[model samples]
Structures are given as structure tokens and as C-alpha cells.
Target chain A: MARSTLYQQVASELRRAIYSGDLGPGDQLPTEADLMTSYGVSRNTVRLALGELVNEGLISRTPRRGSIVRDRRPLLMYPQRELTPQPASVPREAFGFAVSQEGREPSQVIEVSIVEPPEDIAIRLELPDGGLAVVRRRLRFVDGQPYNTNDSFFPHALVRDSEIVRPGDILRGANRVLEELGHPQVRVVDDISARMPTPAESSRLELEPGTPVVEYVRVGYDSDDVPVRVAVSVLPADKHLIRYELERR
Target chain B: MARSTLYQQVASELRRAIYSGDLGPGDQLPTEADLMTSYGVSRNTVRLALGELVNEGLISRTPRRGSIVRDRRPLLMYPQRELTPQPASVPREAFGFAVSQEGREPSQVIEVSIVEPPEDIAIRLELPDGGLAVVRRRLRFVDGQPYNTNDSFFPHALVRDSEIVRPGDILRGANRVLEELGHPQVRVVDDISARMPTPAESSRLELEPGTPVVEYVRVGYDSDDVPVRVAVSVLPADKHLIRYELERR
Candidate 1:
């Protein structure tokens, strides 16, 4: 076995300190100079050690903030567990962008007011056929790059009549709008598949032939197990990483 | 709204059929001619629909065989509650690779050997300090591309001197070997994180600058939470998709 690097040893020591509660979350680790003096390592070595810690998601370092421990704390919930969507005291903003998306994007090219969801979505939402539902389709881009196209279905009775569902800002994030409407998502079930991108999908996503694109069908439900929205997103391969954090129950 | 192509409608219908169990897993779907006749669509349209099904992991098509239904079953067992490192009939071959990797074709590399685990892993494995463990590192490749890497740590004493421990053909995967050795996995806990890849990692994985990687730390254990192996996988953004089938409990 290769001898453990000096930086690795430093990283392990710091990690142990954090996990042992000697360094609490939000606490700052010693500065480079202090670490250098304490560990008799160079500035570069200290930086490398700190970098490893940050990469492990154990700490976050900023120019002004130095190196403070990160919360590495996310709520652990099962993917199969029912999550209730309720209003949040504070709205959370999560960014979605393709690597190649290079400018202002998430454009809304087409918008149509619909009275009902298609049979498939209606069945998933458990809504009656012809029931009022808003069907919105948007060709989303990030940084001027065409990335994904979203076709989102929401029950008209849920938000169709609200201003949040209107034309001008319908181009914004639908999830953000949904949160403001008192249906903060507590759970999201995403069913994903992949295949060669279609000509249209490929062109929109700027994918090459045979390049796989991941397709996700996301269902958002209320605490009552009532499906609120069914959304579809397609991402080009080489651009996105879908993540899910599972906690031991 | 523009009328969707007939092939899309057919594809969606077929998907719904499978999801609803109208077409059971491993059950062959109707032939393209039958589908064309049933939907009153062209052979091309039916072929397109079937192609989409294959991409979505819903069906498999082979020579002299029609599109056979796939086991679109959800392996959504909770990380907190699922049995692991145990004697079971579940074969590792059931899980197919999203991307093809074979031979020594420009893929990531992982070395297998025996070593001591970190304190946390040692404690979980019910071993004292300096306890022996089998360590395996795998470099992942996608279409001849270097993409990700994994390092798995197993109880060395438990697996040492075994064919599965010396980097040879693991007749069965790690757990299967453990079971044959009279230790079965009962549960597994996973820690997941996301961060920017390191310079070495970025270069080795052929990741573009500024690309982030997702890290997964999984510890498979026996019924008593005795950790058998702890695996750490670093997946690049460009080559992988992680999916979860959520069920409301």
C-alpha cells in the first residue's frame, strides 16, 4: 500500500474532529497559517487538506468566511414515502441548469390555456375526465442554451384562477409558484428513464445522435395523497446529475 | 397546442399499459403489425413506439422475438430497512449497466486488496483497530469514457484468503461471497453528497472543469448492524443518472 499523503492525513484528522463533535457545524477550522504551524505543513498542503474536507461535503470555505463546517444535514425521507405538500414559512429556491446552458433561459416559447389534462395525467391525478386543469408547456433554457422542455399539468381548481398561474410569469418556475400557493412540496416522486434523443429532443437539448437523454416524470402530491401536479423534464446526457439523499430509518 | 405525433400517443399508451399491469412484466407485447392494426397506425409508427419502449426500459426486443416486457419493478426498499450482505437469491446480474463497459476499454480502474478501514467503518464492522478488510476500487467508464470511481471496504478477516478478496473473479458479488462464508448482509446505510471533483479526479474521470460529482457512502451490514462492507462511489455529472421510485407509505 502506498504511504498516505501528508494532506490526506491532515484531512482525516480534521474530519475526525468534525465527526467527533469537537468541531461543530458552522464552526470554523483553524486558518492556513495556524494549521501550518500546528501540523508543520506548507500553505499548499493545508489548502489541499482543506479542499479534501470541502469535497467530502463536511465544510464550506469562502473568501471572507474562511472554512466553516457545513450543515451536511438534509431531511432524510424515503423516495417511496408519501410527502405532504404544505405552505412553507420560507420559500426555497433550487436552480436547474444544463452545463451548456450559457445565458438567461428557461424560456416559454408556447403557452396555451387548457381546460383539462389528457387522460393519462387525469388518471394519475385522480381527476374526472374533462375536469379543469392547466396544461402548460415551456421550452426551458439555461444560459441561452436549450436544455430541457417541460410539460406540466396542474388541476385548474388548484391554481388556474390565481395570478400565479398567469401568462407573463408562467415562464418562471412552476414549483416556486406552487409553493407560494400554499402547496409546498414535502415529497417528490420522480420516475426516470433514458434513451436516444429524438430529432426534436436532440435539437432542443443539443444532443448528438445516440446520446441518451434522461426523461423524468415527477408527481407532486398533497399530504392527503392527492396528486397535485405531474411534470415531465428531459435532460441531455453530459449535462445533469439527478440526486436523491436517503436516510436510514 | 400542436397535435402530438401518432407514435408518441402509441408509446404513452403502451407505457400506461405496462404501469397499470395490463401488460405484466416479462409478458410480450403485441407485434408491430398487431399494434399498427390496433391503433390504425403505420408500421413505422408502431416501430417508433416499440423503440421508445425499449429506451424507457419497459421492453426488450431481440431477433426472432417480439418486444418482451421488462421487469419494471421498483426496488424501493428503504436504505434504513432493507436487508443486505445476506443469503438471498437476488442475483447481481439482474441489475444491468446503464452504459456498456467491457474489457479494458478506457474505463475507470479500481484495485482490490486487503486493508484496514477507518474507525467508523471498523466500528460498524464490529472490528478492532487494525482489523483486516478487503478494499476494492473500481474506475467506471461510459462508452469508452472515464466517468466515475468506487472504493469498497470489506471486513478483511471475513473475506481475506478468499477468491473474492484477492481481486480475482468475484464468483458472486461481495455479498454473495459473504453469504457463502456464513455471513449474510441484513441492512445497509448510505451517505450521499455532491461537490466539485478534485483535480486528479476531474482529470481521471475526463470531467470538464467546474463539473461536480456525487459521492455515495454505503455500508452494508448484517442483522445486527454489523457492517460488512462500506463502499464509496464518486460519480461524474456527465455520465450517470440516479433514480428513485418513491412510494407513499
Candidate 2:
């Protein structure tokens, strides 16, 4: 049981304030000079304390705004919903439906292309050697802010004549399209891990410097146990939370 | 698309090598001077290129060893197994079984105590105001290395006389003990999120500088729908991967 350092003590106090709701999202933290005076520490110590909060993704600092508490209301995502059958009346995809349920607008820009898929995705989709795939890459947004990215890959031979190869949004959802094509997914496997965002991902998601991203990959299998679709999602850690419910059988 | 910088070009080449298996785990990367000569870049450019890989968790730098490709073979965790019933002969917990199946030794140090539970845990366990809980805090290890931490909290009134209150490993697991006490959990909800580790967590897990951690919380409810147990696991992102399989009904 070693004692915490001076900077850590200072950081702990501010962290407590944020967690206790004394300071909330969009609330400005005390300036460096004020923090120095209150903590009776040098400016360097105060800056170090603030840096800890930044790394924790609790607050963001700007030249003009100084330090402001960040929004921590992450969107809840249920991966099971995408595998389960949706009612006919609810045609939206899982992401859009989840977002709208929270009273937020969901939108995405899609780019459809046919190409040689990445090796990992090709294996997940069970593509043959040199086999191509149709990929629908989407930059999804909520409330006009870039939230995440979802890229779904399908064997080109199976989707060559389908709407999945077209360059636009599918309002009825791609899962339905797969069902209509007689390749309905009866099972899905999801793999999740987290890591720091790449430079490109940082720019695309407008992520904070220290923010990490969750890499969620789902491979859908048809009733015949053939892999059909592989969907990869890059979710900004600060803005997404994944949930699952299981019942003992 | 804008052109990538000189350093990014160098980094991408090395990244391709790693992903393509041209460079494998524990393989030493080219020396700084060698990279500078091959890429025809300055020392600063080479250092920046290596820094990208480090931030991506693809490599680790050391004063004596320079840089080496990290071991990316993450332990696959199946959260569903914990809820499923096992055979009479298999008494090990899900983690222990999984680790053994992978031919890795699993071990843990446990500390049991009774205390006022955290606010969130109290709500999850549906405990009344001022209700106490018996917490079994475990620092789990794999191959004699600190891997993760699992802290399970139970209502003190429910497990006061049970072995869960004892400070030692439970060979049959605490869940089995709960079942014997007529509190078999039939349903569970799991929430998964990730963030930078706290200082204490970083030291406990012996994580690298840029590593993140996954915070997984599972609340279990008995057949009566009474919440009985809440288990919180902090898994270092680099060492663990979570997987789930869903079948459509």
C-alpha cells in the first residue's frame, strides 16, 4: 500500500468531481492557474493531473475552451439483434433501429465496391482462392456526428445481382436481402477486441488522442453452415457500449 | 485521398510484413540504421515509423532489444460458457477450462471480504440501502503472469455462512456454491466496454504504455429473477479476445 504521488492525488480529486456529477458533460474545469492555487502545486503538476483525465477520456482540452468534461452517454449496441429475425414492420438495420429508439437520427454514407477482400475477411466469408467480394463500406453517424464504421463483405458470386452490389443504402436491410436470396443467416459468431485507433481511424471518427476503438467482427453462417457475410465494425470506445443477455439452458 | 507522409510509407511496409506473416511473433524488427538505409529516410523518420507500430500494439520497443513483434495470440473467452451447465466430472470454472484446453496453466490468488458494496454493484444486486456484500477479489494469472482480475460480489445475507466468505480458491467455483444454497442463477446480463486502464490497474496487469482494457460486468439472476451475483472482470485488451455465438430462433 504505497502512497499516491502529488499529481495522482490532484487527478483523483477531479475524477471524483466528474464521477459524482459535481462537474458534468460540457462543464468547464477550473483553469490551470486556478487548479494550481487550489491544489497548492506548481503549474507542471496541475498539467500532469489534467493529462491523466485526458488519457482516461473523461475530459478534452482545447486552446480556447481549456478543459471540458466529455459526453459519456455511450450508445448501447445489441449484437444479437442483427442475427435474430426482425418483425416485418421494422425494416431498419440494427444500428438505425437502436439509434432511433434513443430518439437520435441515424445516417450513413455507403460506398459499394467489388474487390479482393482482406485475407481475414476472405477466410471468414470462406471465399475461394482469388475469389472476389462485394463490400459495402459505411461511415455511420448519429446526430450528424461520425460515430462508427461498418463494412460488410459478401461473396461476389452470390451478391453480383443483388442490391448489395449497388451503391446506395438498403432501407429494407441487407439481412432481409440475404433471406430473399435464399442465403439467410441462421447463426453468427462475434469477436470483439479493443486497441488504439489508427491515424486514419482517428481522422474518420474524429476521436480524441487517447481514445481507443473496439474492433467487432461478425461472421454470419447460412442454414447449410456456409459462411455468407462478414461484417466488421470499428466503434469508438467512448461512444459505444456492447451488451449481451444469456439464459441458462 | 491525400498522399501519405514519408514516415507513414515506411510504417505501412513494415505493417504489411507483420500482417502477412513475413515477420512473426517475437521476431526482431530491422535495426534503426538498417531501416533508415532501406527506406532512405532520416533517423527521425525511422523512429516515427516504429512509433506508429508501437501505438498500434503491433510491436514493443526496449532499450536493449530495440523493437520486436508482439505476441498477438489472444486468449479467446467465451462468456456464454459460464452460464451453461457443465458435466458432473467438470468442476472447473469457464476460464480455467478454457485456459487448460489451450494447454496453458491457469491460476489465481483470491481475497474474500465483507464490506459495503459500491453503488453500482448495490443497484445491480438489488440490495437495500446499507446492505453489505461479500466480495471475492481475484487476480487471475496465466502461465504465472498476471492476466486479469475478476471481482465477484454477493449479498452478505445470502452467503454469510457459505464458503464464498472464506479467503481461498473454490475448486467447484462460487457459482456452484450458490446453487447449493438454492440460489442458482438462470439468467445473466453482460455489459462490455473499454478504456485506458487506471494507474493501479496498469500496474496490476503489467500493461504496456499504450494498452487499453476491457471492462466486462455480468449480473446474474436466480430462477426467481432475484439478482444474486455481479462479477466484474478487467481484461487487458492485448491479452484477451471475447467471442459469442448466436443462433436465430
Candidate 3:
């Protein structure tokens, strides 16, 4: 195996320190001059090492602040679990349950309205052209900080008078309400991608500059293979990690 | 519903044109002055509307070239298919197969070596302290363009004499080789996250300045409940979309 270069070796050492909790979030790293002097390396090498940490999202460099370690604690999200039946004891929505399990306070502001769905969402929900849908839009917060947004669309004709059309949180989750309405989702398809956030999303989530967001979309189908619900989530890349487990059948 | 602002209205028109392919990839958008005149809005509104497209990653701006639509063709990846048995006629690896299915040629360069695995890989593979592993590192390509990188690691003691120790591309895939050697993977766990690319990765992948990368890690376990393989893939965020289908049990 080829040996690692000087800059890589330096980066590895700093990474180990950060991971081992020797250096923590918001802690300032040694200045470039100090690092060069201590490691017997050139200024370019120290800069390169620092660049690696910046790319890893472990540290941020500013003209005034130099290099400060970033908060690397990402919330774990199980996309698979969101489709399954939650235990009766856990009545909160998936996001709220997950955050509360981590000992974080979870809260959300919701607004519901009926409108002609977007083109992509119309196709996902299999609504007719010009068909209206009830959309429940939510901006979720963790410990009083905006974390993410979730927007779920349901066919207006199917859920016109249902609780889904009301402007409030569904304490038992909208999925359970779907089951009670005889449109239980038996299958779901999820698509995940990432990109820079729009100005509205950035302001809503209070995102720092250079932060990207993961767009997760799920199309759920009933037992008869009829598309019932379409959920779109925008999760800040720095604050969320998605996980899935698959077993061979 | 509240009406959209002037800038938002402008942005929506442009977004609709792009989505409808009326303004295709590489097509130049109207200049700020032209948009201001056409929409009967001020230069600030035009600039804000343009900023919206930039943040959405739908266009690029340069001094010489004002704004051009970006290529939005993302390679779709199914992480769940990697562990499943391939059809009798299709013997290629999951990545290769997926690319080929999209009517694109797939290729890769492989490098094999034995070394002590990284701390995270060691823990995932459940290797003892200081234990070594054989890693097959691949730089994959699509239609002659550098696409992504996949590194697969296996316990050295478990496959020392197997074909996995050699350097050439495994036409039947290393997973098949593992099955032949009595360590078929029966379960797998996938983790997905995104961050900016390191300088080396950016150069290697020939990525643009603002492109982030999705870091995907998968751990495979054999029927005996022993970890057999750990695969890590770094995919450029702009060039990949991951999808999964789930069913209620």
C-alpha cells in the first residue's frame, strides 16, 4: 500500500483528536503558525490540512475566527420505520418520536390548505390534472431551533372532511388516520437527493452559509396499489443522517 | 392562499420553463436587464429571481456567461439491490448493472491492497485491534467520465487465498466470489450522509466548485450473523439520486 502524504497525516491526527473528544465543538484549533512550528511542516501543508477539515464539515474558517470546530452531532433518521406501524405506546409522529428518543424537545407549527397540487406531487399521488389536494405543511423544531420541513399531500376527494384537512398537528400521526379511513399505506417508495437550499428554506431553518439540504420524497400506496399519500421532507445535511436496513428474503 | 411576490413569480416561470424542457440544459437565460424589462420589475427583483435559480442548482453564473441551465441528469442508485441475487443472465455488480440499465456504458479501475482498516471500518467489520483487511478500491466511470469511487473491505483472514486478494476487476462481482467461498451476505445496513468533497476528491472526480458529495456506507452480514464486507461509496451530490421501496409487514 502507498503511504499517506504529509498533509493527510496531519489531517488524520486532528481528526482523531476531534473524534476522541480532545477537541470539541466551537473549540479553536491551533493557528497555522503554531501548527507549522509544532509539526515541523510548511505553511502550505498546514493550510491543506485545515482545508480537509473544512471539507469534512468538521471545522469552519473565517477571517476573524480562524478555525473553529463545528457541531458534528447529526440526528439519526430511519426512513424505513416511518412506513411501518409504530407501537401503540408511541403516538407521536416519526420525527417527534425520534427526537424525543434522543432526549431533545420536539415541536412543530403546521398549516393545512387545499390547492391544486404541484406537477411532480400530482404525478406521485396519481391525482387527475387540475385536481386539488389537501397539503399539511410542517416546520419542525428541535430544542427551539428550526430543524426541517415536511409537507404531505393527500387527495382532496378522499380526505375532504377528514382530520387531515384540518389546520393542526395529528397527535396519532397522519398515517394512523389514513388507516382508520381505510386507505392504509401498504407500500412506499422513497427518493433521496441533496442540493443547496432555497432562500425561503434557509431563512426558515436559519441555516448557515454553505449548508446543503437533503430532499427526501416518499410516495405511499394502499393495499389496492392506489397512491394515497405523498410526503416531502427537506432535512439540513449537517443535521440529519438517513439509515436503512435490508434483509435477504 | 397568499399570493407569491414578484420575484417568486419570476422564479416560478423560469422553473416551469426548465422543467418543461422549454429552456433545456446549456440554454442561456435572459439577462437581468432583459428580465427586468420583460417582467416590468426592478433590477433587484431580477437579481433575486436569478439567485433563486442558482440556489436551486438549476443554473450556473459566470462573468463571461451570464447564466446557463445545468445538466440535471442524476444517476439513480438502488442501495437495496446490491445484496440481492442478480438474474442469471446479468452477472455484473450493482453499480455496473444500474448504469447499463440506463443505456450508459459502465467501467471501473480497481486497486487491491492489504492494510489495517480505518477505525470506523474496523468497528463495522468487527475486526480485532490491529487486524488487517484486503481492500478493493474502485474508481468507476460512466461513458468515459469519472463518476464515483467505491472501496470494499473484507477480513484478511477470511479471504487470504480467495480471488478477492488479486487485483483485476471481478466480472461476476466480489459478492458472488464471497458466496462461492461460503460467506454469502444475508443482510445489509446502509448509512447515507452528504458533505463537501475534499480537494483530492474534487480533482479526482472533476467536480464543480459548489458540488457536495453523498457518503454512502453499507455493511453486509453473512447468514451466520458475522460481518463479511464493508463498502463505502462517495457520489457527487449533483450526479446521483438514491431510491428505495418498502412494504408494510
Which candidate number maximizes DockQ?
A: 2
TM-score of each: 0.47, 0.75, 0.74
Model 2 bad stretches (over 4 Å):
A1-70, B1-70
Question: What residue pairs clash in candidate 2, if any at all?
Answer: none
Query: Model 3 segments beyond 4 Å from truth?
Result: A1-70, B1-70
Kindly give the stretch of ten consecutive residues in candidate 2 chain A with the minimal lDDT sum.
A119-128
Q: Candidate 3 docking category?
A: acceptable
Interface RMSD of 2: 13.0
Winning candidate number (lDDT): 2
Candidates, ranked, TM-score: 2, 3, 1
Question: Per-residue lDDT for B95-183 in model 1, tens only?
Answer: 11112111112334548877677544554455653678778878755435565687778877777766657764352466567667776
The digit string of per-residue lDDT tens for model 2 on A124-214 reads: 6656668899999999998789999999999999989999999999998988999999999988888899999999999999999999999
Question: For model 3, how does the per-residue alpha-carbon lDDT over A1-249 read when each residue is reduced to its tens digit?
Answer: 123669779987887677566788999999999999999998877876777567456788887989899986567789988877889988988888887765667899999999898666775675665789999999999878899999999999989878999989899999999999999998898889888889999999999888889899898889887779999999999888888889987
- Model 3 TM-score relative to the real fold: 0.74
Candidate 1 vs candidate 2, DockQ winner: 2
List each model's interface RMSD.
11.0, 13.0, 11.1
lDDT of 2 by residue, B29-140 (tens): 9999999999899987787678757745678888799989998646778999888887879988777877776566899999999999966677567677689999999999
